[model samples]
Target: MTAVEPAGLAAFLAEHPPFEALGPEALDEIAHDAHVERFDDAALIHDGFKEPTDEVFVVVAGQVAVLWNDSRQASSDPDDILGPGDVFGFRAMLTGRSLGPRAVACGAATVARIPASLAGPAFATRSGARFLVETMVPDRRATDVPSYSSVDDLIEREPLLVDPDTTVGEVARWMTDRGVPAVVDLGGGRFGLITDAVLRARVLVDGRSASTPAREIMDTTAPVVHLDDTAAEALMLLLERDAEFLLVTDRAGVLRGVVCPRDFAISPITVGVSLHEQLRRATSIEELATFAGRVPPMLGDLLSRGLGAGRVIAVYSGFLDTIIRRAIGLVFARHPELSVDAFTWLSLGSNGRREAVLSSDVDSAVAFDDAVDAETVPAYRAAFAEVSGVLATAGLSADGHGTTAQAAMFSRTNADWRAAARQWLAAPADHNGAMMTSLLVDGRPIHGDPGLPAVSRVFNDLREHPGTMRLLLRESLAYRAKLRSAWFPARRQETFDIKTHGLLPVVNVARWAALSVGSAVLPTTERLRAASGSAMLPADSAATLIEVFDVLQRLRLRYQIRQYGAGEQPTDVVTLKWLSPLDRSVIAQAVREISAVQRRMDNVSNYVAVEEWASPGRA
Candidate 1:
């Protein structure tokens, strides 16, 4: 559908409440970018469960019916109905979810589809903010994370299903023939999985006859994932469950297909099949390093997909985590005597929060069992040395704060971690206690165990203790963006510390809200959006801060991508003149939103950290 005359579209949009608040330029941009489409009475405008929408629709003629239950319905039975000048699909754009009040044409309807790229200014409008505040629902998730592709999209072929009595040799032959995942049919809709590894382990290693029943050797406890689950979610599920592959099933428990990490090529980062497989199969540190060079292109592709900044950050951080994990595995493979089961590798700071950027430092820590004494410590250190070398070669920088395993303070026994957590929570104002506490609060298990219970307990203590949380909040206030008019300029050749001013404030406050409310969710966007009705942060402020966070993240990521492409160190410094006028304007608005939140925080507490720099400059 090609775009027609913009004058009519612009006029139609101007009558809508949110678009009415947008200026003529913004409205015209949307109009110019829009393509008109006509739908029949029952045509689906959007599928509410697949992925978020990239475009919003405005009804121009006839009627559009909304089905909040996400099921198609007759025009008369719709949850809500809209006529000419009515808008739909903006909520999906804002929330980045397909939780739709599904739209269906009540009759022959004409609608203008405006892509987010063009209608962004409308999303930044005051009326737009008000609309979100009023209509926005506090969305909770099973995991506080994000994704791009689903398991259904990854399933390459149908599963090779064999009867329960089928011999191991027969199953092996079938698997070899189809190159598809093999499953044993156990009747009653239950399934057991078999693989080449299963054949080797059960039949060969155990010296069992190839005539044994496939069902007996099949893995009955094989992991499973829903067809709708994002590839990122499936990847994490695989790690958490220590499963080789997952049985992709529909809602009714029917096995649709089977998927593995290799099948999940499109994580938030677009690590295609070849690159992901290369990372998995690489035997040398140098090879892993070479493959790491290819990932920036994946990151660039992810940004090109128009996913939310938080999702992009999560994807980038996930890629780093997998690289580090693979590097660890490779190092350990050379040393068969070393057992890595008793230890956990953790990601800290921004990476831990799943909010990392291109140039994020390697903020990592290790927690090991106390049983590994002086004798075993040397071996662990030698192995970590190789891990660090691989990481550096892979372009990950060591943390300036010495938060890596190279630092004595960070690499400690599980018992020692518990003790440190107690100290930080007891006297958070002490030397580097605040910093350590914040890192621990944001710490995520990258490899090994999902988490070290000792480290997790530290966060539990922090959450239970309000005084410590308030102290952390006060410390967060130290990170401020300069929003004053005197220091601000439009389209100037100056750099803005987007991380400090634009990002950190929102990140910090959201952290405060998460901790204060005792919600353990990571990701700044999740924290802010989840803090919906709290008095300190009202629904509107939370919504506003979310928008601000997204804008800052978009600018910072685009800037870093440009810098990375130029073969320079990727930094969070966003150059104003390099940005489009709209981007620069959004940054200004985001800064003001952050400032407003900071002002509210000021009224919430007068107690400040003892550090001189942590003190505030009056707003």
Candidate 2:
């Protein structure tokens, strides 16, 4: 392999964005020191398992494939490929992180590597920097996903709300009592946070009298967080505002309490362990049911605190997975004669994708090892029935649409599952094949061996079946227009099915795009993120869908939490009257973007990439 003679390196840089913005001198400097390396065969270039690298590489010719894993191992599989002029490693370099993904040369290739010490200045240019951020980094990688814990959970005491006209002397006395006076409730929901620092600045330095009204000398610009706001959110707000304390309020905007950075609870891991221990000790279906009942309130609290819906969904799924694993153990104990020992219980659909809401239906299947013969299939049916029966008894209704593990169609031997997957992939439109194939596309194991060969393969079994993926996308368009038609009429009403319109289309589009590129990533947010990197959909299109998905999840969770609080059954069909004006506008904007994604998904070329999945190059 040798470097491309297409043009001098500087000329190439002068044509590309970011590099082009670097000006002629910087480009020459970058080109002069840039070292070219060639690979006659695929070789590991940068290992995520190794020490961190402080340089970036651009594909001079052929391709460099990216793979993510903890251990340094060579593989033919590439999560994504960087072709000629495409850059890699800057995201890690700029962020001061390890590579996090292994980069391997694909076949005979030429690559130019440049140290950050040289290329850093070029990337610092306004346009150049924007390119590195907006283009170089996958949007998901940049996400600062805040961890969970609400102000209500963190606050040590109730707030002391004083009259705005309280004497400065009394306020000063409260400051002596603690470090700040009780807050001045400025009526109409605003607050004046008075601290010792405020006393020093406004009274001592400014020569104000102690007899002045408390409100006059008080500092009113401290950051405010809802009592339900996550500790991480509060901390971010405080840091962003350079505040010493946060004024906490209830959902109705009434002042409730206060918290400082030191008030945060560092106890999630402790809480998780405590809960897992409880699940482990749950020996009866009744006991398991009791533990499962706590999930709704836990999730409600998380949502109430403004935790991201995606994170809440993951937490909720984890709760279910724990309960289900215990349920499996109980099944074996009750029916000790069952022959099926090696098996995997699969969570499908919304649950599988970790996009489940408080009201989302449960769907699942089970795969027994191939050694379990046809004679044992009937014997294992009761075991299958028991698993679903336990979950249903614990309030997780099996809405698998006749595809539950209890059915013969779903509970199958390993060989049978793979064979069925292949058949569905081959003819997706026949005999409800599309529906079955779609169900397994996002299959994930919650119990037993996730690597049970055929069971695990079902997750990405549709990767090579681009035609089936296209057919699935084309078929979705059949009834999509009708969903959008109802969406407008339901705006600002008591409620409408936002799930059918706002959520499903985004999920379907991400699903189609993800499977088309062989990505087995589960969550809808991440699916869209992966789709962008794969070029299965335009980055902006994927980003719009991601934003829309997040908004819909948050709205859905909040709506369901209210319903549950009122002793009503949780549902996605929720009222808009309860939403704040800003929230209503946000939902409206989300719907508009969802519609835009709908238009993009309708195009044949959008989901199905015609180019080689990981080819030598693409300009």
Among all candidates shown, the one with the greatest lDDT? 1
RMSD for each of the candidates: 20.8, 29.1
**Which stretches in model 2 have alpha-carbon errors above 4 Å?**
1-273, 304-306, 453-466, 478-494, 533-536, 604-619
Report, for every candidate in turn, its global Cα lDDT versus the true structure: 0.72, 0.69
Number of the top candidate by TM-score?
1
lDDT of 1 by residue, 1-619 (tens): 4345799788888888678977798888888878898888889877655657878788888899876554343345776788887777765665566666677788888888889777655654434533443333222211122435567877778888889899988888889899765888776668999987788998999999879998789999788888875565466556445576788888677888987644432233223323554665578888899998888777776656545556667667767877888889988888888887867888888898877888788888888877767577667867887888788898888787677875677778889889888888888888688888777777888777675647656665554566776788778888886654543455254767888777877888887777665677888877876666665667787888888787678778878888888888888777667888788788877777788788877775654332211222422
Ten contiguous residues with the weakest lDDT in model 2: 265-274
| Superposed model 1: Cα runs more than 4 Å off | 1-271, 305-309, 333-337, 484-493, 606-619
Residue pairs clashing in model 2 are 228-305, 494-575
- lDDT over C-alpha atoms for residue 159 of model 2: 75
| Candidate 2, 1-619: lDDT as tens digits | 3554434888886776557766677777788788878876568777744667788777777888776554324545676877888777665665556645677878877888778887665554444523432342222232232334566886667677788898878888876776434789887889998877788898899999888898898788887888765554454445434576789888577988877633432212123323444665797889988877777777765654445676677667766777777888888788767743567888888888877777877787888887766786776777777877888888887784676877888888778888887777789788677778678767888777777837445546565666776677676544341233233434435555778866887887877777766677888887777777443467777788888788778878878878888999888776667777777667677777777666655552553475443221321
